[model samples]
Target: MTPKLELRGVAKAFGEKGSPTRVTAVRDLSFTVAAGELVAVVGPSGCGKSTILNMVSGLYGPSEGAVLIDGAEVKGPRSEVGFMLQKDLLLPWRTVIENVEFGLETRKLPKAERRRIARAELRRIRLEEFADSYPYQLSGGMRQRVALARTLAISPELVLLDEPFSALDAQTKLVLQKSFSRTLSESGLSCLLITHDLQEAVIMSDRVVVLSGRPGTVVDTFAVDLPHRDDPLARSTLPATQAYVKRLFDTLHIAEGAA
Candidate 1:
């Protein structure tokens, strides 16, 4: 099967080649996220996780090797990819529905049609009731849901999430995680998530890619054989789930110490 995203011997460095102060953020990192699979990437802080994301998103180019989606090279940000950062970054001036349709509007979608699609997505996020409300009116989790709705409105093939729920309170984070799993499964949309929470990674992903600290590189990958539904109970109590999470914690600990 064709991978949704592929990185082959990718490397990235900052500053000019002759600069002795230059920093290498990632080196010879390679991985493949299969089509329709949700994969999680976890590592210590400043381990170049976001740098990898930036390269894949085309915000930055790889210093070596290549990035590919399916069989073609990812030369730039493809319309088929949607990115959601830690901050929802919704415009406070825009109403809920308006924010959701923001992408469509930028794409020059017709106003009426955009509204139609936006409303559907808002309903999917269970935020239809807040459609006319402004961003400030929604709670943080609700706002993130709105952000996700906006991302999905464009129907991108792959969603790149960078610690999307890290800022939320425990309760809100759990709620959104549940909703996200259902949404991903139902939509069959592929995702590459960068997160620090091992349990979250185990619960939400079909696989987890663990990276080493600075000059980050993929040190290990594990298939999450646990049940895929995003339920807290399954994540905490299921023997298989607990085992995988524990295994990953050990792996991360080893990776961090080695760095």
Candidate 2:
């Protein structure tokens, strides 16, 4: 089967044309995610992790190479790709249900059908109770759930998640990450998650792609081969899991001022 998403020789540079100060965010970055697979990208801070996400989302074009979604060249933003940034970015002025329905309105989906779909997504995230609540009234975790619900409302085949749980506390982050992982798995949606948490990447992704700093490039790739990675309890006790985590830390050397 053709891959759900593919990037070939993808590279990006910032600054002006003449005498340009080239900061190659991603160099010859190429990968493919099969339909229904989840992939995580981990790197240090300011390593151009978000830049790669932007390139994939078509928010910024590559200076070279091409991006393809389901065998078609990605010229502009496609409806099939759903992106969730670090911030929930919910419209405080709109209610939970209204925020979820915002995408449908832009897509010009009908009211009755949109409400039906949005309600289903909200229920999936267990946020149906907050359908009428405003974003400011909800906690950080709840607001994120709403954001995830909104991303799903559009029914995108590919989900691009950028540090979706970074801001929450340790407990809240773990809770939301588990919920997010379960929801993504149940939906069988292909995802590319950009995060600084190695453990989060290991627990949530089938494969982890590591990037270099400054002029970012794919430095290494590892498959999560732990048993019960999907189970929160099993993830911590497994020896193989701990080994992989150590290996990743060593490779990135985040503890040694690699970032």
Candidate 3:
């Protein structure tokens, strides 16, 4: 089967045409996200992690190579991809269910069908009680879970998550991390997570891909082979998790003393 997402020697540069001050964010970046696999890409600051997401989402075009979804070149945003960013961006006026229905609305789905899907997703996240509540009424972690439910409501072939849980408190972050990881695994959806947190990458991803600094390129990729991949807490204590986190830090050139 064709990979759900593929980037072959992809490079992205941002600048005005014919401008001398061009900035190359990514170079020779090639990787594939297989069906039902969650791949996490980790790198240091200014390493163009988010730029890779933009190219894959079709919000930005590659300067040198191709960004393909199921062997088809990405010309523009397609319905098969979902993007969940740091901000929940939930409409304050809209209720939790209403916010999730926004995409289904654009798809011209009937009101009943949209509400059914929206509530179903909310229930999956154990937020059914808040279906009638507005975004402002929810807690930060709750809002993020709502956002995840919204992203999954459409059932996209792949979801690109850009630090989706970075803003939460430590306790909330861990709770949501476990919940989201379990949900993604059970949903059987492909995902690409761009994050700066090494432990977060290992806990949430099936394979972790490390990138070099500045003009980011693939430096290393590791298949997380923990016995219990779905349980973040259970997996973290194992020696394999420690090894992967150490390797990731080493690859990012982070000194052991500083880390």
Q: Rank by TM-score, descending?
A: 1, 3, 2
The best candidate by TM-score is: 1
Per-model RMSD to reference: 1.2, 1.9, 2.3
Error in Å for residue 143 of model 1: 0.2
Provide the TM-score for each candidate, comma-separated. Answer: 0.97, 0.94, 0.96
> Which regions in candidate 2 have their CA more than 4 angstroms from the true location?
254-259
Superposition TM-score, candidate 3 onto the true structure:
0.96
Clashes of 1: 0
For 45-146, candidate 2 gives per-residue lDDT tens digits of 877788878877888788988888998888787888999988999999999999999888977667889899989989999989989999999999999999
**Model 1, span 44-126: residue lDDT tens:** 88889999889888887899999988868888888888999999999999899989988887686779999999999999988
The lDDT of model 3 is 0.89
Write out the backbone clash pairs for model 2.
Answer: none
Candidate-wise lDDT, in order: 0.89, 0.85, 0.89
